[model samples]
Target chain A: MDPVLLLDVILLLLAVTTAITAMAIRDLLGSVMLMGIYGLLMAVIWADLFAMDVSFTEASVGAGAATILLLSALTRTGTRERTGGDHHLPALVVVLITGSVLIHGTSQMPAFGDPQAPAHIHVAPHYLSQDIGKVSQKSSDGATRRDFGDHVPNTVTAVLTAYRGYDTMFETVVIFSAGVCLVLLLRPRSPLRREQADE
Target chain B: MNIDGHLIAALLVLIGAILSMIRAAAGPTSYDRVLAVNVFGTKAVMLLAIIGFIGDRSGFLDIAILYGLVNFIATVALLRFVETKRLT
Candidate 1:
């Protein structure tokens, strides 16, 4: 196997182990912290997949802000998880079914970086050819254009801002709405709720 | 396939993360687990830097830097929340 592939597999294995351990742990705080580690590992995997924009988002928001939120919530809630319940059989079956379904779903998708895959065959070619800043290649007959090297080299930024502007706009709106929702729900209104007595 | 300095360094950092994970899972005190996770986050920053270099994308460095700053801030936030039981 390629070293890069080896690294990817190792990272993924670590992520899986951490996630399972997080779920199994009795201490809620430890589980949340492990989740933070899992987020970072997932960010690394996204970077390895060449989705730098997604990776950046994962690193900053998923791993960073989310961890703080979980920790703060933990402070409000007690850290000790209530010990195990009696019904493990149904839950185990559900988890197993979910895991298999997810794996099966991913198996049907094109392997990573397969250039001729459907997604690559689609809008990707358009993004590759249409350079706002510079013309990449002109046909010998001067009719067809292909190359667009002089463009906004970071096409992810360009595409997100230009072609998929609405999606990005809505995404921003969603994040802003989350903040508004948090403030609405969390900002203490009554004085009694203000001073939380330790349970 | 071939082992070299970059690959070795990345592997080492990951091993460190694994050890941190063990410590975080087994620590008697929540604080110890928190500290272990912080160390893991720091290792994650280094791994990101190495992975960025391996992939020839400088943008990975940007994520690594963000992780460094965010990880520190998160740790501090956790400590404050744990100590005071409320976030002002």
Candidate 2:
């Protein structure tokens, strides 16, 4: 097999294995640290796949921010616990059924990197072939040109900020709401505050 | 650079995830569970980036960066709130 394919297969296996292990460890803090390491590794995998932007994000958010937050939360709470108990039979059955369905569905998919696949022929080709100057052109060939000069080179940014800006706006609002909700839910009661005031 | 190294790395991560999940599920303290969940979130971010790479979509990297910033801010805010119990 070609080296690239071999590398991909190896990386995939590594990712799956780490995911499983992250879910199983007994030490909470240790597990969190491992998860951060996992994120860094995953970032490398993303780089290998030519998704540099994604790798950067993963490394920053997954490896840095999220891990710190979790650790802080632990400091407030404390860490000590059992692993788990017997699995629920029903949940197991559901998982197995879902896995089977997904595996079966794979047969209908275009083989990886198949040039003839609709994904390669349609949207992607348009992006790949188009130059920046012709983004607004409506002609069949001209339409393919999507200029990055006016926007970001990152497709996700374009999609999020341009094509789906409204959705992102709403999502940001939702995040803000969550922050508010957490504050409200966890805040001390007014009565308790008043009592402290009296003291 | 054998593929086996990558595979081993992923396996290690999976093992870590399982461990975190167990902590989340059986943690005696709220903090313990929170920590575990945080670990899970981190792992998920990494996973998304990896999947994007595997799919050859470099654009997904932008999303990852945004997510990272948001995640950090949220965590810090939560920690502050927990400590001060006020929107200071």
* Candidate that would win on TM-score: 1
Candidate 2, after superposition: displacement of residue A12 in Å?
Answer: 3.5
Residue pairs in collision within model 1: A136-A147, A136-A148
Task: Give the residue spans of candidate 1 off by over 4 A.
Answer: A88-162, A192-199, B1-3
Residue A118, candidate 2: C-alpha displacement in angstroms: 5.0
Please give the lDDT score at residue A6 for candidate 2. Answer: 50
lDDT of 1 by residue, B3-88 (tens): 46789999999889899989988998979987997998899889888887777778878888888888888788777766886666
- Give residue A18's error in model 1 in angstroms: 0.8
* Interface RMSD of each candidate, angstroms, one decimal: 1.5, 8.7
Off by over 4 Å in 2: A1-7, A112-132, A135-199, B1-88
Give residue A24's error in model 2 in angstroms: 2.2
lDDT of 2 by residue, A1-199 (tens): 4434555566567567666766776666555655664665576566666767676767776666666656655664545447567779999999999999999999999989798999868776555444433354355765544465454575454444444768878979998997897677556559978799789
Q: What share of the true interface contacts does candidate 2 keep?
A: 0.00
